[model samples]
Target: MVFGYFSNKRREKMLQQLSDSRPNLTRAEYVNRLVKKGFNKHQAEIVHDVIREFIQMDNFSIYPEDDIHKIYAVEDLDDVELIDVICKKLNLREVVQEDIDELDKTLKIFNAEYILTLTNHISV
Candidate 1:
């Protein structure tokens, strides 16, 4: 069966890896940590919700420092969909290469916090 954009085997492997590496935190604690890191509550929530929906994972399991590349394969159709969903959810302008370059990092190294920061500056 298909799971999100992943095949069943790929999805299961991803979920298993995530479960093994997941941080020990409640949802409230996770969000609070994001806010403590300078992300506003709404931004944190959006990141949490979007990631949870995107990967079909427990949102609290995701950490700001978790590398997006490690979470899933990059430059795939799913990657594009993730960016689109985040932009739409945050009402942000379309993401461009300049914006990614402004972060001084490539998509290969992006994490949840980087996403929040990127979108924060891009919001309409």
Candidate 2:
């Protein structure tokens, strides 16, 4: 439908903007940067994978500081699905209402680094 076309076009533009805002590091570089910031290698990789999965953008161009809310509009995103995927991929316990509520609280100006923090609080 016409609405779908426009929505896709808008999404593509937003993705380009997001990509242009960050340094294009290789996956290894991204992981290293995260490790330097104190995330373990496994945590860094999981965060990268989650962002790459949700944003459909090259992880190389996505940095820890990137605002997730800007990259994907909150209203348009399925928070439950996102949280579920993160939990599943991270081998954390299944998503619960508290997890959803916690995510909602952090949704404002949330960045990639916050994902790492969130996972830390959620049980494995």
Candidate 3:
């Protein structure tokens, strides 16, 4: 009797886990829900598909950094660091950052570095 009781309890617990893991909703039941809410099957399916696609989030696993955390600062930083920070702000798009960084790096090397050196060398 004890064994049977433990077995039943284990089964109930397992079933509860499964139910929590995935909401068990059949397509027909979903359709019925839509119909009651004044949607035909075709319309409901279209709307459902769009919602599902949005929720499903099928995309490239490699997100460009920005989607995770945003970075905002007005200062000077190296190219790679700037790219990573900008990617964090721009939803991880590296291409734009790469182009901008190239221009920034070149400009710094050609003129800004000289200007900074001169400014520092001056005495008050």
Candidate 4:
């Protein structure tokens, strides 16, 4: 897996160990806790990024940034915008619910309002 989120070898090792120990934790759960424990968003992203690659069988290039707003506003990250950043960095098009409980849990962690705003432009 691409532990690209951690630049520090020590932190990456810690994250890898945790991943090994907790194979059942949802991605958002692990990621949210990691952020709470001082892992920045970029670091959390690495975990999701690699996992997305692992699960993405269709090679979809456009992944939305939040559970609600599939329509991510691109704030000019060079040639590619926010959605493009999500695609290039994470290769995701959706933040799946997996289950109702999991969906609610992630929504709380990520903030439902922000997710709604970001995903507002997206379609089914």
Candidate 5:
């Protein structure tokens, strides 16, 4: 069978690992942990960048009003704007069409419904 980008078991394992390490960890720290766990430097960096962008785009914040505001703000992002934001948040160099495609694909794999809600301005 042709599995998705990440197999289900691997996905679950990664989620568990992230959950275990999330507390008291910064983005860089978490990425470092992933690197130590056998993720390559590039993979770890992409994972870090994507996770941080996901956190920023999440509808839940410290305050309910902030959550609502964030949802609306994120809903306004076009694909290019979204990519730009993710790239800026990640401090990535040499972002290209392939990078954006990879980001979009990864996000879709993370949560298909989320792409519809957050990126209504672009066709995914």
Candidate 6:
């Protein structure tokens, strides 16, 4: 009887885990999400492919400096970090962070756009 009870509990736990898992999304759906966030269809598609490939890489990590926690979604990435990395990778304009009011405002604007651009609705 005890064994049976434990087995039933294990089964229930497994079922719960399965139900809690998020469903996988189609590529089109992911692209649509990016488009809605202000990216043109072409840009969205390109970004989608980039993100997909990045996630699939064996050693792909948003936060390479930190091994304990890695970013898998847009939310996991900070705007400053995202913009900094992207700028460096693409040779874009450099961004500076300041604690003053003007700098804070500039960072806010960049964050608003960068967050939407880097983040897809799907979990990596």
lDDT of 4 by residue, 27-76 (tens): 66646755665544663566455435543322322222333121122122
lDDT of 3 by residue, 1-102 (tens): 999899757755654564466555544655566566454465444433433342232321111111111111113443344334333333433434445444
| True-vs-predicted CA distance for residue 41, candidate 5, Å | 1.6
lDDT of 5 by residue, 19-97 (tens): 4553545556655655565544554455445534654533221111122213223343343454455445445443456
TM-score of every prediction relative to native: 0.72, 0.72, 0.28, 0.26, 0.28, 0.37
lDDT winner between candidates 1 and 2: 1
Q: Please provide, for model 2 over 1-124, each residue's C-alpha lDDT reduced to its tens digit, 9 standing for 90 to 100.
A: 9998998799888777766776577778878887887877887887777777776655337666667666665443564566568778878876666765786686655665666666777864
> Per-residue lDDT tens digits of candidate 6, residues 23-119?
4445677667656766656544554454545444333222211111123423434434544554444444555443223344433333323433333
How many pairs of residues collide in each model?
0, 0, 3, 9, 0, 0
Instruction: Determine the C-alpha RMSD for candidate 1 after optimal superposition of all C-alphas.
Output: 3.9
Q: What ranges in model 2 sit over 4 Å off?
A: 58-60, 74-77, 100-107
In model 4, the worst 10-residue window by lDDT is 70-79
- Model 3 scores worst on lDDT over the 10 consecutive residues at 62-71
lDDT tens per residue, model 1, 9-124: 78568657776776566667768988998888887887777776776655336666677666644445666577778888777778887877787554456677878877877774
lDDT, residue 90, model 6: 43
For model 6 the TM-score comes to: 0.37
RMSD over all Cα atoms, model 6: 11.8
* Alpha-carbon deviation at 47 in model 1, angstroms: 0.9
* Residues forming the 10-long window of minimal summed lDDT in candidate 1: 71-80
Q: What local distance difference test score does each model get?
A: 0.71, 0.70, 0.37, 0.40, 0.41, 0.42
The order of the candidates by TM-score, greatest first, is 1, 2, 6, 5, 3, 4
Q: lDDT score, residue 112, model 3? A: 18
Off by over 4 Å in 1: 1-18, 21-23, 58-60, 74-77, 105-108
Which number leads on lDDT?
1
Q: For model 1, state the Cα shift of residue 110 in Å.
A: 1.5
